[model samples]
Target: MVALDVVHASNARLRELGPGLVALFVGGTSGIGEFTLKAFVKNTISPRVYLVGRNASAADRIIEECHGLNKDGKVEFIKADVSELAEVDRVCKEIQKKEKAVNLLVQTQGNANLRGRDESPEGLDRKFTLNYYSRTRFISNLLPLLRTASTSPPNFARSVTILSAGSERAINLDDIELKHTFNGMRCANHTTTMNSLMTAEFAVKEPSITFSHTFPSVVNTGVARELPWWARGALKVLTPFFKPFFVGADETGQRQLFHATSGMYPPLKPAAGSPVAAGIPLPTGTAIATGSDGKVGSGGYLVNWNGDITGKKLVIDYQAEGVSKTIWEHTQGIFERVEKINEARA
Candidate 1:
């Protein structure tokens, strides 16, 4: 596990990297995303941040807080419900029009609804869409900008998705959407596995853009707000007992920032000049991380909460069985179907 002192020391170097770094945060209005956004604004020089979420009031307060921390930081809120693919596309278009490239893309948009399977208006499971499909859609739409950032002045581009990493369970290829088997635990495992596979595929396709699917461990993000009253009450009663195990929101943010900029997860081709150009020191202690392909620094990483690489045997076995490619094809098919439906409606 990487020490907190190491994470903080690395994050403090963001200011030295200079100004005009552009970052996009999905679900940044609260929880870990908000914490990371605050840390980024506090440490970076003249940072331009795009905060995307459905909460305007929260965005207002967050923007105010960010400005208070870094007077030169430019933070804009683009309101959208990320659970829908069409909405994700619209938000990406809006961002693309304003920025030439994006240096950092952090996605922590998901819910912990334990009541049961809830479907969205788009005919997809709400949690599944928010946790996997919508996040993938954002990455697909923003690839060009991320690619551009890799070669631009900042010269480094990375995407980090906060979700279950090391705890990935078996994925049923035939039941990709979990239509046949729909339980909360099963759904969580399927989405987490999909996140890891799809992220690995993306890293292979775009070696220049570092991709990481991280498990944030247990944090008091209040993600269980949609749970039933009984479950909520039980959680409330047990909060005092479980609180000690949860990581602090601010510390999680610092570790996340380290994952985004550190040399530990370097791009396929190390950019010209020292690793410091991208903001952190050269990777030390841990050997260069093994990518999804089992090679060192091939540009994809599965990280755990303590800032360590999570090389799960199941993930490796699935990739060997060609599950990653199959998952990618299945995801593309869903996106095509969604696009056709949207076009017909239009």
Candidate 2:
């Protein structure tokens, strides 16, 4: 487990790099995204950050607090319903119009609900879209700029998407989307496994940029807001018993920021001569994390809540069967079909 002290120490060193970092947070309006983004602003020196979500009021409050934390940092919010692929494209276009490169792209967007199979207007499953499709859309749309950032030294190109990292189980390869056989549990497993597979693909395909899929264990966040009153009450009544395992909001921010900047998760091929220094220098006595490909220094990481990588073996056999190609092709088909449908409608 990466200690909280080490998380703080690495974050403290961020400002020393002096301000060329450009970060984009896809779900920064609230929840884990906001927490990590604020911690990032606290340590960064005048970073140009784009905050994407549908909440402008929340963005105002977050920006206000961010300015209070670091008055020089620029936090701009692009309001959009990210469940739609077209909206994801629009957000990416807006960011690309202004910035030449984006150093960090941290995605924590999701529809935390048990409503099951909520399909967006784009005809994709809403929960699946948020958890897997949209986040990948951000990474795909922004790859050019992210790759551009990686070409530079201290400014690293990293993408982090938060979902159930360790819960990757054997999914139905015939129906990767789970469109026909959808349930809450299946949705969770399918999306998490897809994230793992895609992370592996991106890591190999673009070894210069670092790719990580994380699972933030249990934090006291609005993830339960959509729960029914009875369920919410039950959780509240049982909160204290499980409180020991809960990571505090502050610590969540710190740990996530550590993931964002720490050198423990290095690229397959470092952008600069010194690969180990991709983000902050590696912490004392820690080796580079083992990637999802079952190899060290593979540039793709499936991280756990405690800021360590979880090389879950459930997907190993599928990996041997070359599942990454199917995943990438399926994902690309979704993106292409969605965009074409949107354009045709227009």
- Each model's lDDT: 0.86, 0.86
For candidate 2, write residues 1-346 as lDDT tens digits. 9988888998999876667589999888998899999999999899988999988999999999999999999999999988889899889999989998898899988866668678776888988898899999999999999888877656478999887888888888788888899998888888899999998899998988889998888888877887888888898899999999988888888888888778888888886575433678888977788898889878888998888778578666668887878888999998888988899878
Model 1 C-alpha lDDT per residue in residues 1-346, reported as the tens digit of each score: 8888878887888776679999999999999999999999999999999999988999999999999999999999999998889999999999999999998999999887775777766667888988899999999999999999887776778999998888888988789987777788888898999988877888888877889999888888876677888989999999999899999989988888888888788777756864553336654565567776677888888988887888578888899999988999999999998898888878
Error of 1 at 197 (Å): 0.9
Candidate 2 residue runs with Cα over 4 Å from true position: 153-155, 274-277
Looking at candidate 1, the ten consecutive residues that score lowest on lDDT are 274-283
* TM-score (C-alpha, index-matched) for candidate 1: 0.96
Residue 270: error of model 1 in Å?
A: 3.0
TM-score of each: 0.96, 0.96
Q: Name the TM-score of candidate 2.
A: 0.96
Candidate 1 lDDT: 0.86
